[model samples]
Target: MNPWLPAAPCAPGTCAAHTGRTRLRPVAAALLLAGCAWVLAGALGAPFLPLFGPTRRERLIRRWSYGAVRAFGVRVRVTGAPVPPAGTPGTLVVANHISWLDIPLVAAVLPGRMLAKREIRQWPVLGPLAARGGTLFVDRDRLRALPATVRALAAAMRGGSRVVVFPEGTTWCGRGPGGRFGPAAFQAAIDADATVLPVRIGYRVTGHGAAAPAERHAPAGAAAFVGDDPLPASLWRVVRAAGLTAELHVLQPVPAGALPDRRALARRAQRAVASESANRSPESVHH
Candidate 1:
């Protein structure tokens, strides 16, 4: 088995559960179409992003990302300090992998090049878009390619690009224990001397009676895109779900040199995210 291609036990049949209430079929359909258009618009416009100044480019990426999420009828709630602007040292934005929405959610705040599996570069619409957006692809199936991928990541960061990565290597049911963070991505940060920013990505159902009292505001399984779950099925589940909210908790940033090795850094970052994931309680929705 390939070490980089770890299997997640979260299958769609068992993990992706939806609230009893959903939007009308017609409304959900419209939202899905709008969401696709918004995404395509961003992809088509990606080439022009480099023409703008860094500040303006960041602003455009944030706006487009937020708009894409809202277009799918999902509300976004972000907490914690804003990500530091792109600069010499750059940043490695790390997060838990839940659904396809994770990509845009991270970009909504910290717009940067993405570190994704090479397979994503061959995925239909998203593949082309990712390539056009300057995504760094890794051939996880080949152990020999690992060093090259790390070097590429370090180069991108040293060039002042904030790189986002989901070190879990697989998606999980957001409500339960997530996959472990692989230490490979941390190596790039160490090599580049970049800042490591751990962000927790979660989804919740909102509105009156949307969930049982105990489960209210808990992570929503409807948004999970785990093992063998078709992308279309996941997309439709999100659109039909009533009052879905995507939450991004940006934790404190740590310098790469603060830790002795990549494994230590990975464990520290993972612990921070796991703590936040476990401590979710009913809270007032602000939006």
Candidate 2:
């Protein structure tokens, strides 16, 4: 009935805290502090800090990103510890998308350039860092832009910089569907003749169970999903709550050259990621 607590809705902060949705305050505070902490660190890291050069800077950024998220109770579990061909030789890394949280989680945890959406580079606090971290973005609406974007992505790979792309295109709530991605990124990797490695990220719930009217705490996956809207209002609600520790598993690398073709590679990638995770389902990668 109220703006803050409207009728049932999917987006955060529109439903009552007990409506099996995010409680406003915790979510809001978490988002606020997360932003501030990330921004402040980068601001201090400075564009010319020398200490934050491409390699060092990226690692530093990911570490801080992981820490900020940990404070929010969203533990990131990365499986398939990077299988860099030739022992750290440059390769293109692809994975399925779980949430917007995936970007920071991977960026902060993995060392490489990320194939991200052009829009994220415009976000507050995170945008600048992404651009500097060498993240490549594709504007789906602008098809012509693909050629240039792909070229840049290839250059990074050839230059010995590991680039990560989420062929899934967008984020998921990590419960419904695994995710879907376009074939363009894959084609680009093929064109570059870069080996593709698949990675899986799973966030497990350590506390609580299914929903109950009087059970006002949290559900199974609550530790990772509750009140995370990247909005000031919702992040505030998660800060004080204790979140579960997430698990990460790194799978072996999948080479494009070993597959029959690009399509086959994509299909096998889906099966590989879905094959042996304890609880998560199969994941599909976009081209």
Pick the lDDT winner: 1
Model 2 lowest lDDT segment of ten = 1-10
Clashing pairs in 1: none
Model 2 C-alpha lDDT per residue in residues 42-109, reported as the tens digit of each score: 65564664554555665566677677666565655553444342336557667665545566666555
Clashes per model (N, Cα, C within 3 A): 0, 37
Residue 4, candidate 1: alpha-carbon lDDT: 44
TM-score of 2: 0.72
Residue 221 alpha-carbon offset, candidate 1, angstroms: 1.1
* lDDT of the structure predicted as candidate 2: 0.56
lDDT of each: 0.85, 0.56
What is the Cα-based lDDT of residue 40 in candidate 2? 63
- Candidate 1 deviant stretches above 4 angstroms: 1-4, 86-88, 209-216, 277-287
